[model samples]
Target: MSWLALWLLGAGLCDLAHSVRPARHLPSAVGAAGTLLFGLLAGLSSGADLAALPLLAGAVAGWGYLVTFGFGRGRAPMALAGYAVVTGLLLLIAQQAGAVGGAFGRWVESTPLPVLAERDPEQVLLLLAVLVAQMSTGNVIVRLVLAATGTVNPGKGPDATSTLKGGRLLGPMERVFIVGLGVAGHATAASIVVAAKGLLRWPELQARRDAATGPSIDDVTEYFLVGSFVSWLWALGGLVLLA
Candidate 1:
């Protein structure tokens, strides 16, 4: 089978594991096995030398998801640790695979999209912009969804805190930490992509929502907190995969 085909299979398996875990609550070992299979196949396509890259990424992702969602009270340390573990594993795979070829050299040559390729600055700056855009956009989108679904305060006049309560957004602390961790992950992955391909794409700002208010402060805070994490995931994924 082709490498890309193998990657597709692995990705499918990974998603399957994710889907089954919530309903069936499969054993952690089963999930680990799935990740192992995914890593093996994904490494084949990525030319990542680390034989265990898939396992590592899966474990980190699982831990992050669990700590933030499944068990704990959404600690920042867990999020940060998860990001570090995943990114480090990816880099190790790249190195082992001998894929780190002329990272900075390629940036001078060409890019996939002339427009997005033009914005190749330090990974930190790029990461920041992408993260901000993601959070802001997600906040707006989630708010609209809530308002349309009658979940949030309607007809305006509510403050930002009230409007966002019960909307799946995390509290202020969680939001800040998750955003920071996500940006870090993006930077790490972006660095790898840039090093390998020379060119990368910049994410665009798509939307913005009014910070309207609602009745419940607690609900809005939670919505913002949850939404922030989601935003981080979206932004980080886009930077690493889309770029």
Candidate 2:
């Protein structure tokens, strides 16, 4: 659970750093160092073997650095690959150390908060991570997919400008709604969110359709379709992790 929290914290902070302009590297560096320190403390507090500390610190720090670097450079594929590899390795290590059932779990179980009384700390940490991922991290991932598939390009172009306008706010809200609905076993209701987005954007999309300049309708539609799908997938993936 601690590892999971640390992983999420590292990833989230790195993504946050990537989202900020000017002095991005500073946050990335600080985030990586913070993750390492917190990871070490978490490990020790959880009674994990001292011998595993180095590997744990290395994994957390490396994840932060790689994610920050990859996103900063617009290397979506590299960031995605790094995430997979590092998270996989961390999961394996956690399994070996039996790190999921420790002080955090006990505390979560004993908590008085009605909302969390029945939930484990792992679930809570995972939800927190998912929420964080739904922010800039999710946007970065969607853009990466779009770029990789040639559906969009980065710049001040029509599609890019349109997305840049409100996507940062909308993406996180939709993801949180989707994940929340799915967690509550109301997945069918989640479709309303998808519909609402389309309806709300219909006016804007229509307005753009007849514009004398900017990207073609095809490019805009493709960007919307691909980006929305990828964003929703992130939320669904979080649901899977929770399960």
Candidate 3:
């Protein structure tokens, strides 16, 4: 569980660093290296068998590579598929090692926070991973989906800066809201959030329809619909993991 926390924290920091234009590959590289080192240290501290260390290190390294470089360079579908595979493998390893229970579970149970008190460490780690994904990773997924579906063309008309102002901030906020509501057992409220987002964006979308220049209404609408649905799906998927 400590190793899981370290990996997630590293991944989240890497994603946050990559969000800044000036701090590109170096931050991610350092994060990958750090995750490997810290994960090993965590395993050692937690008294995990030495035999499992290599596999744990390898999994952390692989996850770092996927999030930082593989996803950055590879096709969207392939990268996303690889992410799912690696995540599943890591969870399996954790489960087998008994790292998903025991001390970590006790710690979580002792914590006073209502949101976390009932959660096992594995679920908490998974929630943290999901939150991190909702940040820059979510943006990557949305853009990749749009690109794959031909709803958006790279290096063409109104770049992200000119067109989708504030989307980066908005995407994470909405995902967090949805995930929080769902975790609190407010599924209907989460649905309302989904509808409200569409309503809020409707005016802008309609304005685009009236404009002569910029991306066509159809293109913008497709981008919004595809991106929003994929983003919501990621949050919902996280909720499923918590369950």
Best by TM-score: 2
Candidate 3 lDDT, 151-222, residue by residue in tens: 764225564325556777898899989888888889679988889988988887787777777677777787
* Per-residue lDDT of candidate 1, residues 1-243 (tens digit): 111222222332333344346443343344445444533432333534354445553563464244324223334444444434644554444434422114332542355644435544223223333343343234433343343333433224434332323323342223334445444444544334223321211110011133233334444444444444454554455355324
TM-score of each: 0.35, 0.80, 0.77
Better of 1 and 2 by TM-score: 2
Pairing residues by index, what is the TM-score of model 3?
0.77
Clashes (N, CA, C under 3 Å) per candidate: 23, 0, 0
CA lDDT of each candidate?
0.37, 0.67, 0.65
Colliding residue pairs in candidate 3: none
Error of 1 at 84 (Å): 3.1
lDDT of 2 by residue, 146-200 (tens): 7667675423554354532677779989998998888778988999999998888
Clashes of 3: 0
Model 2 per-residue lDDT at 235: 83
Give the range of the ten consecutive residues with the poorest summed lDDT in model 1.
199-208
